[model samples]
Target: MLQYIIKRLLVMVPTLLGVLTITFLVTQFIPGGPVDHMLAQLDGHGARSGADTGESATGGWSYSGRQGIDAAQIEQITALYGFDKPPLTRYWEMLKNYVRFELGDSYYHHQSVASLIQEKLGVTVSLGVWIFFLTYLVSVPLGVAKAVRAGSRFDTVTTLIVLVGYATPGFVLGILLIVLFGGGSFWDIFPLRGLTSDHWHELGWGGKILDYLWHITLPVVASVVSLFAMKTLLTKNMFLEEISRQYVLTARAKGLSERQVLWKHVFRNTLLPLITGFPATFIGAFFTGSLLIETLFSLDGLGLLSYEAINNRDYPVVLGTLYLFTLIGLLIKLLSDIAYLFVDPRIKFTAQES
Candidate 1:
């Protein structure tokens, strides 16, 4: 076990370097700097003014300057961030700084990246937790039902629902839900947003929760449907496969009841595959949430944070967040491999024998 752990840890070095390289290259492809994202739209407006009234008409303020990133500003930013240095030197510096957990500043927001992360982490964490718990609460029972009823009307209906949930894009789903639920035209159940009211702090604790729930109701429903559908389908397929195994047949032939055959013999083994997929699902959900569900719902999570960072060319925060999320995901996958031994007796038996 110790050797296995050491081996995994050793593998992380190259993985981290690879992550850094990929992030750096990908970010370079996006057009503009932080200044550009803010000012690019203003170029045409400024150009019209320049055409009507010459540059000298506005105290020599050249309105018809470059339409994209300010080259001078970009150069300064590049030099400041050591983009002007040798790539190898910068890479080493990045590796060293990250080792000390110094992720640097948010150039866009003019704040420490760490502090910015601390500020917005609560909402994303809270939403992720609630959605995960709700998903499991609903999915487990539904998965079991689908497994038991394999090809019946119940399974067919559920399979179709899951497929649709998986197919639907998060932004489309989010907008549709807000229109249906938060617009007050349909059920008239909740607010359009998914956070506490503006005066949320002034309310009593119970009142606060109530109001928060009201706002989050639509977002939560959207999140749960997308999340639960995938988990339920995976668990159902695993359970179905397990139910037909020779051991399950033997248990039934031994006069074991349907419940006993399922619970004691089938469910346990079925959980092995599910357990293997668990870490990837959890980690992928964390990163993709920034791009999808969180973005649409206006949740101030790491996902939204990354989006803002990219748009504003806040390289430090963007790179820092990317590395953190990637590191977490890679580690989770590694651990999942190890967890399989505990989840399956055959794996444990092989390890012990070795």
Candidate 2:
């Protein structure tokens, strides 16, 4: 197991490098980069200053008496943002910094990318934990019941509901939730935005907890809707498959009760897939499908931050976040495989077979 883990960790180096290379290349080639944005700002400033003083500001005066940026000044700006360096050189430097856990400063936010992520991490983590717990807590039991009562009225009704939920997008659900319960047109039960009330600091500990839950209720529900449908269905299918297996039949034939057969024999086998899936689902809680939900609820999280960073052409934040997320994803994949062994101890990972 230790050898397998070490091997996986070793493999991650190239995987991360490849991801960073592609991301860096894309950012470099994309239009409206940091240089262009800076030039546009400078041009706008020059135009306004020229209008006020009837003279070209600073440098890059055109013969036509128009405001412009000279090549020297442009070079200075480019160098300042490290854009003047060759792409490979810059990529090498970035990799070195990343190896040391240095994400550098955000060009737009004027703070280190790591610091910005740290500030936003708590909200995303809170949402992720709630979503993860709620998804499994509800899904597993519901799925088991549905599997046991397949073809019954309860199963039919639940299948319809699950299908409807699975068909609806999470963001769309968030919008519907806001429209219904966000105090504008209909019943106002939940807060429209934010992860906490304005007076959160003033509240007692228990009050703070309740207030946090209150604010997060709608967002969490919206986020979990689609996940619940998928997980519940997956669980139900896995359980049904296990129940039909010969082991379950034999267990029942050995005089075990239906409950014992279900829980002890079938349920234990059904968990292999679910347990292996936990890592991706839990880590994905931090990012997957969170952008619109965070935006709708005005939750400052990594998803919203990444969206803003991309739109604003904030490459440092974009690349930094990408690198971090990619590394985490790769690590989680390794952990998932390791977890598979725990779920089914019969599995083995020999170097030759692997």
TM accuracy, model 2:
0.90
Write one digit per residue (lDDT tens) for candidate 2, span 1-354: 898888889999998899889989999887667777667666664245555646545322212222477989888888988998899899999999999989999887999999999999988998999999998999999999999999999999998998898799888998888888988578889997788999999999999999999999999999888888778988999998898889887888899999999888787788888877787787767789888888889999999899878865789999999988888888877877887776688888874553
Q: Candidate 1 residues 1-354, lDDT tens each?
A: 667778778888798889888887676555554434334334553334445556433212233345476778666756765567776786678778899888887776778888888888777776666676777778877898899999999999998998898787666787788677655456666666448778999999999989988777766677667777778988898888888789888998999999998877787787776677667567644565545677666677777788767655678898888778777777887777788777664664225653
Q: TM-scores of all models?
A: 0.81, 0.90
**Worst ten in a row by lDDT for model 2:** 58-67
Highest TM-score: which candidate?
A: 2
Task: Please give the lDDT score for candidate 1.
Answer: 0.72
Off by over 4 Å in 2: 45-67, 351-354
Once superposed on the true structure, which residue ranges of model 1 sit more than 4 Å away at CA?
Answer: 26-31, 34-84, 348-354
Error of 1 at 58 (Å): 27
Task: Give each model's whole-structure lDDT.
Answer: 0.72, 0.84
